[model samples]
Target chain A: MNSRKSVEWRKKAGIRAEQGDAAKGDKLQSLGRLEPLEQLESLEPREPLERLEQLESRESLQSVGTLALNVNEQPILVVDGLTLESSSGQKLVEGMSFTLRRGESIGLVGESGSGKSLTLRAVLGLLPRGVQLAAGAVQHTVSSAMVFQDPRGALDPLCPVVKQVAEVVRYRQKKGRREARAEALKLLGLLGLPESLAREDRYPNQLSGGQCQRIVIAIALACRPDILLCDEPTTALDVTMQRQIIDLIATLQQELGFAMIFVTHNLAIAAEMCSRLIVMKQGRVVEEGLALDVLTQPNDPYTQMLIEAVLPLPERAETDAGAEVEKEANERSGAEGQRIAHAEESMPNTVKKSRMEDLKEDSESQAEGGSKS
Target chain B: MSAELQMEQVKVRYGGFTALNHVTLHVPARTTLGLVGESGSGKSTLARAVAGLLVPDEGRMSLGGRPLEKRRSREQRKQIQMIFQNPDASLNPRHSVRRILSEALRFHNMTRGRVQTEQRCLELLERVRLSADSLDKYPHEFSGGQRQRIAIARALSVEPELLIADEPTSALDVSVQRSVLELFREIREELNLTVLFISHDLGVIHAVSDTVAVMRQGELLELAPKEAFFAQPQTNYGRELLAAVPKMPTASGLVR
Candidate 1:
């Protein structure tokens, strides 16, 4: 397929083509047109296509018992009917079930209070004081590692960023400090970050939100565990940075070949990342399926409602009347380099027109009605 | 003042850092105005300042066309009620819904009689779509959406003229979020209350607001009708925010 050639070529080209430099980027863009691989080198990496491939490679269930369990296969982690109850007897989550196979990625998705995080916490034996794992069985292949939402929240303010990552490497792998620090740099590079950040002895406060998240990912990867659990890893990041982190995780999953359980509220993100998606509501699996089918054609009404509420703004409709006004403002504020860096592409025609006409009509509408306070 | 609530050149500062800078917004009698911004943008600061929770560094504020005193009187404080985003966090954990509402009524000296107050509490809960049975229940028993409705009922218990909500549905999921938003709409119309709704979600802003004010970095970027703001945003930041919204493709690879 055309995709195969382009993906192979881009894989060879690597970082040189990933950056938007015209020459290598042009070659990469052409590669994107060939097949599934061609999409990988497009202006933005083809995440959904890559994710779909990963989804298909997941293990089929041998037995359709209440919880997913296969006798012959290695169970990296097994959790059955996990339930958490608060002090007030409020059922945070109940009757949740799932199992992870070796080198598999399973995504846990639900609104807040659906017990997605609690499920992960129960497996790790880390439930909060008021909460208890009232029911369930948690068995795992090996010790697990976790990456939290806020890097600073989990990291010690007194310690340096590299030191925090090194501590994990030293403790879990029993490596020397010097050896751990050296390994940390390699992990940072593998995650596609500059080597300089890995060397910096600065604290998490000094780094940007995206950079801090990278450091958190670095520490999680340092342990070299059989299973990795991430809780809303990209919730705190901007859109562009969010894409970078998701790509990093996907790449590492392929290379390290570790079982993973990703928990997040964003279905769009879940659609583009996970191998198999497990939908939860009031503590039960409402739906479970291949990522694409779950997002595009949800069987459950709750899941469908969740998808519809996303409010996809027209990419290019120009329906937004404020576009021209914003454009003028942007032109004034964003001198050459600034505006070019953040230019909007992938906008649809409907949105483009809607945004343009929205502004044009605003002036006429203002004239019809007197000025508002 | 031209309306029931008016804020001019309001500035809220913590120590040396400015949280709100020269913010001027007016809420006409019984009108709903949506305040939209991301985290650290100071929309919540403005809401708190209006509710008298935080004194502004520089600004004149008035309620009911009367300039507010340097320190609000007990009667004056009751007129502006603030409904917090997280109902579970805001409500007293030990108090039943009945005690929660009655305490507000008694504290404000608005209670007529015990039987009447109990009846009023039931009415308020019913107004927010809760049944009379909900009065005996604790706040922890309800869902995130239901708890939010209870919070709204408590806010209404005071019978305040202005309502300030900071990211009310941000923590709830979509299905619950939509229902909560509809509840707000119903209360706004039925009560003829003036509302100042603050949130970071543009989708929620579009769903609830008539007029929208876009704020960035503690400054107002654009203020316009909801349709106009969505159609043609007037500021660079505003456009960037609009563009940042993710596209929902109807079919995989085929642009909807």
Candidate 2:
């Protein structure tokens, strides 16, 4: 409900603000709760929310009801007030709304049961058994594809990895088998799969988790869909592999220009990859804003808890060697300075208390002889 | 100083592939050793070797200065315990929490009577910060984090000298992960348990471990104090892994 109001206000203000209606824009912006106009100015139509802002800009204020109809020129996908219910009438997701323009990346972030994945599944028309689209509408003008969390499960266990990718290309692009195979190899190469692995007739089980995920991405890319829905794509991956996948998706989004809605439970990952974020809880959107703003200065208590809960990196000492390593690390990765600062500020008080409590328990246990049997 | 657990030039192979290659590591009696690497990097294999589930193809492992037998004796088995990544898989679905924990206690001969066993079970659950009421519930009834806590309780039921936790918090939410990582610290201190925590997450490794071991492609890359490892990793691969971790987003304008 709050998100809907902000979306309307942002839609109106983004138009007037960009159109140089300073007085009216500032007034509307002030009414909007998420971010200031200056910050919102950086907001691009890359995410679903920004498309809504773009939608409200094109229509008269009274004609906001026609939002779904005016999707010809902009917003490839519009999900408005989409609700999901079970056969028993239990609401699984309520009033979830967002829009996706071409080449935008939005992150849906929350805890495990927050319905982030379900929302994406709903958009793909793949709701689980008994869960039905009970209310609202999902209007899309273009084809879409999905990348799942468990790549191993999403892929066919019996199919050769390249053939699986090639099948999607052959079916969707309507290319001949040989041409599709060639195109599939090229796509796999672009995704950083080696020639040896990509060319081999290897089953999904034969490849590692990272390679399987790459093949899955290749399949999603083969469809050449306008929108990509990723549901916790990197949740099953290791940190290094996760980083690779994030970098790959970002690069592909830039190169291919596909609108993306990424679902993840990690706020840090969301902050890195998505320009805008929508925080969900109990099948409802609790907060939505620029990813940086939501992560750094969250308005919702649930979001704040998520930020504080992130395990801070270990504090590095100021030794000369340490500084050298830090310098090398920073040069290799540009985000180190911000990372250190955030880690310093967001160290949880609960962690500190637990550390102290642990020490106290340690001494007490030693006094009574340790619990080692 | 004698280490609680020691591995020397350990090697393991599956079919023709080497899963662990000439790896050596040590965990002090009362400290945590955080083992980190990408998937397929032999972290899990090393944990399995330590837990006596996989006998190393070469080299020797010793606990408390005694050589570990290829087939561990019942007493030797009681000295170490493992907690797996997925709590649901590690725990039996059919058993109640009470039964799951009491079975461990009885199998290990930790308690003589039902009353004493029940008391020990309650204490174990309390140590992991779960309510005593959870004892009657099944694994599926609890949340992922709670299930993990129960898994920890079952591992502690044996009062083993060494605990091998393989990505125990990876399945949990960030908030839940913090509490579980904290619980690991508290338990390690309270019970003086030596921990070998395996994870792909560097942040979790940093939070819970005193020493850090970096593994890559079944080989040890770098092993150092937690502070040193984070500050200046010895190997390029280790540094790359550290740099690859997604940084927490700070407020805009805090830094360029």
Candidate 3:
């Protein structure tokens, strides 16, 4: 029975590939121009890891690190010297390099316009309009999936949530409609979505932000992807929802053992979720190291600034009394107001002081105001 | 202390859905009150009611001891201003910063003549920490944080007694968010502006607010002084919300 199912799956896969080619043909005809997408589409679908394993075996005898190398372990994706350029030939991302090993997670950390998201998009062959992969090669060793910051943007507004998930399962898993529906429901259940929400007819608009994100994750998992690329998946969520989604992603990563590349501007999140962190600024990596070392003792000034910008939790109360004393000292000199003015001057371009520190300064200046009055 | 803005059991409903159910809140004169909740908890609804965009189904609201009308008069509208989560949505893309601020200045008859209006606009920009050179630029020319500053400047142009900032910093990056929050603090201190700050982020609420109110499912759960709320929340929902906040990972027993 298993052999018969395998035969049926292969036949379905072949038919699906042919249909994909036909669809690509229609796209090419409509565009009236042959693009590089044709080259990507023409490549035959093969198990990515199998090719890597064959390459490893071929080079085993000549390899110098054979004694120390773990034969069973291999990187799921290797991005080498990746370069992205705009239509005007301005380099957006230059010489980007990274690797994702099976079951490992890496975080790409940067400010806005830092090309972190662009690099992630480059790996999925989904560069934005006018942005092209000017150089570099991405050796994707397995199927991958992406979870976007806003789940609503990624989902179809008119389609039912369950139908969307089941559609991915049907196409990627080569399952029948009924089987795909069952699998989709199971995946939604695993993601902790409610029965009412996981219903077959509920549109994306009907669900809450958190529920929509869960559906998006369910769809991504339905493909059984070997690599999960999350581009600020939790950024749009509330604090509680963000924590839930983060934990859910971590748990799913553990259960499925998929390599993950999470992109975020948050240092605390990068520290908590990723084992390795890559700090990016202006389309180039400034620092890359273990998450613990990079967060605790960052080498780059930009990385340090990013770390300092994180709002420290308000769990400690001992600092309040110390701040009170400092306020008194500053008030006595009548320079408290001047200090604040000085702080404001340097606020825009550089990393300003944290909120708590500013609060202390506010109280000091208020003390000066009271004394003057 | 006199309350600058007061809500007495305000109830807002949307076709059988209670967006806000008999919620009462008050912002003391010249102080900041942070209202925090999950999405759909009616925080935005309360903000709308205060801004005269939404009329409550039940209960009364007052501004400076005067009963607020369902549709505020032009004079009453000038006493309160609102800043939204997305500055891009609130700002007009086609208008320059000078045009936006001058329009607000002229609407309230706050200034006469182009010279006086330009001076007042420059003052507004200075208050929000933007330079005068920014006057000629459009909304798209500024970054997210800068556009928000422009929005604040426009809001302050009318010199409102109460400012309603609903998740003003949520769309901004963390580094930029701190500077904006500091600007809010500075404005409150300088102008003595009574602010009703709404956000889903507790850390931001803790940092900027003198008082904090927690709401859930259209119901107000807890309201207390900032320190008191953080020290020991009175409700299970409040406790759960606080616990759910993702904490900054500290280094080897160091809290900072």
Candidate 4:
């Protein structure tokens, strides 16, 4: 159960010959060891696993347990020999497998049609209607929640975002309506959406794409997930917003100590967010390893190609001009860093941007008070 | 000479919300102006305003130094063509590629007859890197990248002097985006068409733009030559935006 130990489960696995030790990645578990999703649905929940969660944290439904055990070394999610096919039996994902350890983040990297997303869907037991689990198993014991790629589409247009988050908090956490709303606002605020935005009963359409995404994550957080499945959650966002969301998630993960499986096509982002990288190519695991090793010394040509394809930002000369820009970027963030600093981490730029809106409202309210006086 | 797109103090409003607030921009002749901003930053509003899809409340727009009339002539309309992000929405599902390209060609009076129109359609297909045989296919038959190419071909079919590509490659996959961007570069050079390429990705902007325009909250924060802007953006917000782009850890010179 060592964190870096490679469990050589399946001898006949396709891509594990180079994975073990060299890449520091676990070999894909073969068939028959874990239960498939369909069978697990009807089967009674595991007694000790349910007791493990219940025993660990019951002071509040949202509270996570102190990880006193050597839990980080144990696998939390095992996608062992999973194969997905269409209703027409056309193979979409073939023999895909990976193990995610508790509090250890792994990234699924691949372009379109590479089955990276389908593998995530299989883990969540929410594969699309046409797709079916053709073989293998998903052995996840704890509860999980997913943050979708398109925030707008994932949300209900009719529901106010606060109400939407409260609904999940109330349903899953079984809280009172007022308490649920309060919790939702607190969660949203931690995600850097201030009370001015989160407290207002705003629908998904009224909010920006970035705001809606934060609310979506708030709802997912309300589930108190032990495993967070993010499917290209920042793909539709602008670069700045994407950075904010990635920072928010990373901070939340640190506080909550949850394992995450992040699926994205951007290798740079994957390297930034994850410690381990699993490269998928045409429905198979092409390479899996420590993120830096996979990125720096790729064993697969496709992985190497993906690293090459990452379009770098325009190179900056670290002269007086570059220093000036760095200063300017930091100076803007420092303006309101104190007010919003407590609840956030690594959110200097975005917190300032959002606080500008708060300050605008604050000045208007003060003006109204003066007029009344 | 390729036409330069000029917007002087252009303002667009949706009731109380001022989408584009007195924004001034100039896309030089035959050059691509990368309009970069987050959502609700009025990048699309500026695009729609220039394409004459929406009227700006108060502004002057001149195409190649000629003031543009609100009610443009058919030729004037043909001079500016727009390609939207989603090809599925813009390209009619019912029409074949041939019919779509031919309709535009016939409307612009760019082709002499039916045979010439067909010839022109094939050339447009080749221009966008699609096979000439793709002319017979429907939008749904092609992959997303191919469909985007078809959309680009349709935009080119009219022989427009200015191409307004609003997030043309954003809907595409990362691998596909590069090839499509190369097509945009090639077409711009070959036709000398002024391009207003709007995107949210700075990487995409760095790839295609000669001049970069950073917009936020209905204002143009900074507009500079890509080299100058990238090295040291004048505005603090622009610098923040530049800092936000993810730098690959293991890439030779990149470290965040």
Candidate 5:
């Protein structure tokens, strides 16, 4: 524990963590444009008068922040003393508080029923029926969208995938059919889905689990959401497919520059994509710190247990450092390029096959080079 | 009391689609054989074939050098037990844990009278580290991890020689998964049972398996001792699968 290298590493981490997200506010802008409250109000169903009428003043106050909030200067969300209770007065989430800076990513890491998902749902204003906010406030300046755990279940089976995305574009953006469809296609393409499938009109049933998830991401993006809420989004996918989805989401966040609140039970994932990590257990914050500090020098027993529980990465096949990972990147990009080039002739099948092969190749090689057994 | 499980060129086809394409594998007695593959790669189908849940179109499966027939005899059926992925789906919601465990014991004639069956059910619960109070609770009353334990308990009720677990811990949290994997390992050693453990997570497979098997598109790619397979896979496809696992960021930022 007293090694010189360890001390230097800890010192370096301390300096990095204290830097804060304040420096990155300048170049960041949400891919989804900000819309006025009145503009979004008209997009709501006319028959939802009863629901809109029931809107609490607290919600309106938050919306006001959404307007006065500038992407460059202010924090996107500030949740203060948030408490959640079930219908029978059982406290579900206790005194949760965190600030999500503009265009920065924060992860809420915990085990299931740890209230991480509940907290994310509360922020998105979509808590399951009977669970209400008991105390405190969730105030955000920008509107958000969400990606769910089960991709296929989140989508409509009866509708074509492209139509489903375009519908969200139509409603949220108030764009006409041609413009909306074009926007939807652009979003899909951004998520690494092929451009050709827009013409074929593939249904959810026809696409692979990974492709369907990309479509779901496209739907979320179509809203032009300033912040993205993701809840165990890749749990249902195959590992390689899960990797692809994670990579795709990270890339999108980079290109679009949206703020993110990613909730996951896996600490390894949280470490990869998040700058600040909040470790929650049993509806309470157990540990909150910079992701590097939390991963490398965990203070809480629960956080320590989670870090240990992650399966160690098997050794890579190539002994020379970084070559395998570099090759993996090259293969993925090459295959993705190949996928886009040959996408139209056999839209659904070809895309799935090529992507699977690409992922399978890396993992297969990884498994070979990995575990000492 | 346990025996090896062997599958020889087992082939299963549903309509025109070949679910198991001339695949062959073996789980040595008193050892675990871990199965890894992506979805639609026919790993589950192969498990079903070995369990006698579905009749394979071709090839043979044998337990301890004896043929495991397409339609197994009652004794043969009792020798191999299968655990499904979703405990909620596998366990009857309306039935109490006591009823579920007792039913399996009685079906295999593990005990005679009600008192004896109830006694055996309690033992099954104890084997999986659940308290006696859990006997009266329904599956829904238990958490995801506890429910999976109940599933494991029921699978062990018949004292099967070969255990088929299909992604049993995939539904559980990591901390819970660690305990379940431990229980499985302990049980395998104590009973000398041959286990066909399937999971997409290589970390898990690494923890339990004496040997590893890879399958893709219904075809077996490679089979080797866990060390050799992970160290230097014979086939290119096998190496690629190893490469595909999401690397856990290790301590000191040195994780693969």
Candidate 6:
């Protein structure tokens, strides 16, 4: 607390910095980047409609209105005052009420062990051992299927993907193997997977995680279910793959008109993908509203915490890392704002250039570090 | 066999498939180094190699700055501890929390008698933010977050200086993950333990790591000061990785 002690603490921090403590150094370094994150503080949160504008503006040919094709028909699966309990008589989910209309999407966001997954499993009548739907009418128009997070673990390793997909058609539609096989290829293609995978008599081991997940989606769609349950399906995937899978699911919902109950802990993914959102905490729904509204103006403190945790590094941070060594050298501008503006103007191409430069720099650094050691 | 561990040009191979190629890493006394990479990037392999579970074909490994024995001795093996990806699988099904945590302490000769072992275990449990009542319960009785705390307790029971955690919180929900990461942070500071945190999640790596080494396809891509890695990513892989993160539009008046 004294002046000498404060000076000692500062000296210790400097020594730690010299000793290569990145947490200390990064705290000292982030002063500049915090400028932008702070700039965010002054800017008003844009309406979801405005966010939608960016997406829509990017794709004029994409049918936005058609996305709501089967939005408000009827409750495809209505849970009327649902209450679930474990065999030990402990209540899990209570008084849960929701209507998932055909082609509409609903996200169930919650913390771990909050009974979000159990609520979805109750609809599928696939509750884990000793857990049952005590009181609920989980009405469904047609068959319902689940897409899980771990594609590698979800699918049977011994069977080919086509066989797995075809099995669903056979079980649900009573189709013959030959007919199901033909349909399986079509479904896989529809799910944005290659038809060549159908020809490969190889097992799940032959496929990548992304391809395996696509196969899982194909199987989920094989039954042509009016409602589909996706249980943290994209949680295990990388960001780019997660984006592609989300887009794929959205496309499938538009084309097939299957209602989706997307259960996940990721509020950002839920915000980007779902139209309606239900925020859950400790087995109770804390908030429920349109996804955009809830994400933008969340009433619940838990929901706010969830939203704040989904931090994303800005685009400029990624592209401005001197990865584009050539750009840094060749395009010399005096002012910081001008450089950033010019970079923004050539943003698309700059990203590619930066990436290439970064790769080169990484390899060079590895080589240098290796030799030095 | 020494109490420390080192990797010199460690290259892992499965027949012709190379999981790690010429990767050199060092863990000095009482210092944590965080290893990060995408899937299939050999972080797990690196962990396994250090744990003596996997032998690198073309590299030398040493403990306490001395060359490792042709085979790890029991004492040498017990000095290194690993916390795996999933707590669900790592803990035994039949054991109670007390039995599980105490067993590690007894196995490593850290405690002598049952009462002493229980005392040590309880202290560890308390340090990890678990109640004394939890000692009598089974692993399945605890939440995923609690189970991870127990896992950390078990890892610390042996008094190992170096801790290698492979995606410890990847299975957990985000809020639970924050709590568990906080636990790791506390343990690192309290024990001055050297930690090799292996994860695919950049957010997690950034939150806890002092230095981060990025790996790709059995190769060490970039190792930088955590600030340098994030502030000015020098590799294309790192750039694309940063770009792949979905940006939350800055409140243009609200973070809402």
DockQ of each candidate, alpha-carbon based = 0.17, 0.34, 0.18, 0.41, 0.33, 0.18
**Clash totals for all candidate models:** 40, 2, 0, 0, 20, 11
**Model 5: share of true interface contacts reproduced:** 0.51
Highest TM-score model number: 4
Residue-level lDDT of model 5, residues A57-101, one tens digit each, is 234222101111133766778999899999999999999998886
DockQ-based ranking = 4, 2, 5, 3, 6, 1
Which stretches of candidate 6 lie above 4 Å from their native place? A1-77, A87-89, A125-136, A139-144, A170-179, A192-195, A238-243, A254-257, A308-373, B1-6, B27-31, B73-75, B112-116, B246-250, B253-256
- DockQ for candidate 5, please give it: 0.33
Tens-digit lDDT string for candidate 6 (A171-287): 444567898777677777777787677667558878777788898888766545556789998888865567678878876665445567889888866765677889988778899
Taken over the whole model, the C-alpha lDDT of each candidate is 0.71, 0.78, 0.79, 0.79, 0.78, 0.72
Give Cα distance to truth, residue A186, candidate 2, Å.
1.8
Which parts of model 5 have CA positions greater than 4 angstroms off?
A1-72, A317-373, B254-256
The fraction of reference interface contacts (C-alpha pairs within 8 A across chains A and B) present in each candidate is: 0.28, 0.83, 0.43, 0.76, 0.51, 0.25
| Docking model 3 quality class | incorrect
User: What is candidate 4's lDDT per residue for A157-189, written digit by digit as tens?
Assistant: 766778777776655555688987877777777
In candidate 2, position B109 carries an lDDT of: 92
What is the Cα-based lDDT of residue B151 in candidate 5?
94
Off by over 4 Å in 3: A1-72, A197-200, A316-373, B1-3, B253-256
Per-residue lDDT of candidate 2, residues B1-256 (tens digit): 2248889999999999999999988877888999999888999999998888888899999999889978888877988899999998999999999999999899979999999999999999888888989989999999999999999999989888889999999888888998898888888888888889999888889888999999989999898999889877778788788778877766432211
Scored against the true structure, residue B194 in model 5 reaches a CA lDDT of 92
Q: How do the residues B36-105 of candidate 5 rate in per-residue lDDT, one tens digit apiece? A: 8888889899888888889999999999999998778999999899998889899999999999998888
Report the poorest 10 consecutive residues by lDDT, candidate 3 chain A. Answer: A60-69
How much lDDT does candidate 6 score?
A: 0.72
